[model samples]
Target: MAKKGDMLYAWTNDAEIKKHAELGGAVTGLWKFALESKAVDAVLVITKGTDLYDAQPVLISDPKELAKTAGSLHCGTLLMPKLIKNYFDGAANMKIGVTVKGCDAMAFYELAKRKQINLDNIIMIGVNCGGSVSPVRARKMITEKFGVDPDTVHKEEIDKGQFIIEYEGGHKGISMDELEEAGYGRRTNCRRCKMKVPRQADLACGNWGVIGDKAGKATFVEVCSEKGANLLEGAVKKGIIATEPANPKGLEIRGKVEGAMLKLGEKWRKKDFEGLGEGKDRLKKIMTETSRCIKCYSCILACPICYCVDCTTKNPAYVKPGELPPSFMFHLIRYAHIADSCVNCGQCEELCPAEIPNALFMHAQQVELEKMFGHVPGVNMELPLMAYVEEKQERARLKNTGSDMIYENVFNPVLKN
Candidate 1:
């Protein structure tokens, strides 16, 4: 039987699944098995809506419908965790199997810590993420940079430091560095994200290190939990999938690849944060940028860290309604409440109407908070010790009823009990 910490090169036993799925179909095979065996009530997946750029999330109830969710839609930048929280009763009522990127996995934990999600009922299968390009930006990059119509593109891959696309006639690739330098690569938040592999999930699957003959023909899966080990062993025993021990060489290579990604993340973080500057300088930049906010609450509604039925931002005691651009308090409230727990999912900035660097500012503060308080969000199930006592109870209460006023002691936080 498979066990936690085992790394295996895995692929599907089914010919059709093998033919269609990217990198051996291990992830798709696991989801299909879960659905067919009733291991999960549904598998939440992203599928094409209109074109390659139009990635929509769907809840697949039947194993037969799994084919539509097969393959990769790297352009589909949607987060799966919030959908579970908002639509599926936070997976509290039904067992859910989901494929998550680093951000989605991180968000899941954050929501779970906030008591917005019931994690025991959900199976999280994490995929390694380099980053994702915005659908619109991807289309534009294809047309203007790749010199091809977006519709004609059959597949897109970010491999070997290049953004490669297979079109109707032929495939073309351009160095990601070239594209990013020219301002047309991954989302700004993605560039700075260091969560390359979400070991927080039960299984962390990726095509990063299936070397030798298995290269490009299998997924490298690291069994991260007993749940993952059980699922993998079951699939192998049932002939739903096949697996072999991962190569030691492949493991070494994977480590190097992850190191490179982390270094890149730090580089971007330094650049982004340095530009924002210190204290009053950063505050001034934030205030100036937020002055354009129409207070549409797109960022608030979309932020995975935010899950209040009655939002404090809308509380009239703090924020005066009908004020154009709102007040600095509006933005401060968000920074105060979210900065401690922000997973930097990029949803806030992605959905912002004013194109504010919302994630950048939030992440910048999160780093500062991490240094000062030693609380890192979404890395584990542990409640942040800084807020683990009476504050956690009050925060949990405020999530539903909300305070008529912001808590006064938010700044002078008590040490964890």
Candidate 2:
């Protein structure tokens, strides 16, 4: 059996699956094996919808139906964990195998910690995500920048710092930096996100480490958990897939690639948050940005962490209904509730009609909470920072806290003269 941390080069033996899959159909083959072997009751995956730009999440119970979910959709910005939580009752009734991007895996981890989903009943297949583009924006970019019909585009990929598109007769490529400079690249949240590999998941699989003769023909699979190892071993033993030890050089290159992506993300984080400034300047900026909120509640609705049945934003005591430009209390309540658990998933900002940089703000707070408590959200099953504080006095103070307490107690402690 494969052990945790074992890296292997693997590919599907099914020619049809290989032809349609992004990288040798290893994920597809694994899902097929899981279903046929009755290892999972269903497979949750994203599939191309009406057009290549429109991607939808699907739950497949039959192995034969896995083909429709093959291929990668970089334009798919949907988070699958929320779907499982809200629609499927956290998959409590079934065993599931699901594909996850870094954000999805993180969100799932947070959900599991809250007992919303039973992690033991699920298999998570992690995909290495460079980033994702907003579909509507991507379509416009393809038509205007690439001089191609967005509807006719066959495939899109980000590699070697370029956004490449394949069409009927030819292919075109443009540097992502150039595109972003022209206001057309990955979503701002994705650009700043450092989590490229879903290391928290069962198996992390991608094309990053498959090189030399196996380049583009096999997937680099990192077994992150015993569950992942078992799935891979079972697939190989069942003759559904083939595997070989990954090349050491290829593994090194993969690490370098991830490092570069993380470095780029750090640069983005600095660029995006630098304008917030410090002290009153930062407070003023946040207040100014949030003042534009029409209280549409889109951010709260789209948030994976905000699962409270009686949300504070909806409570009249905190925020009056039909209030335009909702009270700052609404925003404050949300930040306090979700900052420790925010996974920087970008859904809130994406769904916000006011275009508030919700992810950036929440992530900034999450970073602070992390440093203060050494609790990194979504990387593991660890409880949130507030969970460990057992002092009743401190809890009472926290319950009665206001915005000033953050600067006084958290950000800048008052020193006695």
Candidate 3:
């Protein structure tokens, strides 16, 4: 993960990159950094695609480059990890700087542990997330509600009080009161996502007071790791990100949902591993659910990992030309092959037309694997179960007692205990 002249660059958003790096300040309580800080040689800012909320990752080695690309924008987690990997792979020997949302950082962590990329030399910057919307859905919502083409709407903005939709004709603002009463605006993923502390990050940054408080104008930033702390100390010494601990009000603004996610994560974390359906019966359940799969292979394309040269589904092996649903065996075999390594990211479920909870099935399979083989798939930095040579005892663990295969491995009349 390290090499000569490598600088890990990261960004919170376009506004953060330009305003903070250029003025020697920090944005939204993110750590402040002076362009002169040697601890961070460069910065990479991500920007919202022109006319789109989805931001494409951008790398900046020079302060000038940082200023140019940074500006007002939104961050979308869906494409962030893919963008990070794309940039990291191209950098190769040189260390790169980058920023990621909570889920993106988790995905990166999972990938890094698997040795997909060496991230030790990379700098990680993290941002607190409120989640984001799909462009298609957002546009459709605006068009239906506001009676205007969403793309023609001059601007759309979100603030503590309301969601403001500004059009060429006029602007309409939806108050937080209304949004709450109407049960609108928040993304579904946020309801399920539990990571809030940025506990896995090096630095956590944000603008705590500025959103609702006009008088005070400091960003709320916390150093979550030694590397982040050292960088912040350097910035503070140089008067770049100068501040004291923020008021406790920001936490209140985050309110019940953040607390709910934290509670859910804690609750799930404490559950006994044995309670996760990690038995042969559990494995059978997974196989049964997968049997409903119609060889759609949509899951393969949805997966970030199944990056094969040519998938078997497309080859002459199983699929015939113009087949209706391919074959059920294709999906069943794929589940068996990839379930051990699956991270349960839920992409397959998200993309499934049948609304099958493929991720849940994979999660159950992973639980079974963890119980029997002592493997947890993508989370561990150590080698995967499939990577290891199976000991005689280990192989015997899979066979049912009284079965022929079990008898072959375990039975000896002279040695029976």
Who wins the lDDT comparison? 1
State the lDDT of candidate 1 residue by residue for 40-129, as single tens digits.
Answer: 999998998888888999998988788667788879889999899889888888999999999999899988887878999889999999
TM-score on alpha carbons, each prediction: 0.93, 0.91, 0.63
lDDT of 3 at 131: 46
In model 2, where is the ten-residue run with the lowest total lDDT? 403-412
Arrange candidates by lDDT, descending.
1, 2, 3
Query: Which digits, one per residue and each the tens of the lDDT, describe model 3 over residues 1-417?
Result: 212221122223334443534212353223225344544444555655677555466655555455445333442335344444555562346555566566556655555654445566556666655445445556666776556677776556555545677777888877634543344553433323455544456676544333344223444455666766666556555544454444456545444545755675444433423343556765565556555656666777656545443455665445565565555556665666566666545567656666666766655565567678786543335666443433344445644354223233344554345
Which candidate, 1 or 2, would have the higher lDDT against the true structure? 1
What is candidate 3's TM-score against the reference?
Answer: 0.63
Relative to the true structure, how large is the alpha-carbon lDDT of every model? 0.88, 0.86, 0.52
Residue 340's C-alpha lDDT in candidate 2? Answer: 89
Clashes per candidate, residues 3 or more apart or on different chains: 0, 0, 18
Least accurate stretch of 10 residues (summed lDDT) in model 1?
408-417
**Comparing 1 and 3 on lDDT, the stronger one:** 1
User: Over the full model, what C-alpha lDDT does candidate 1 score relative to the true structure?
Assistant: 0.88
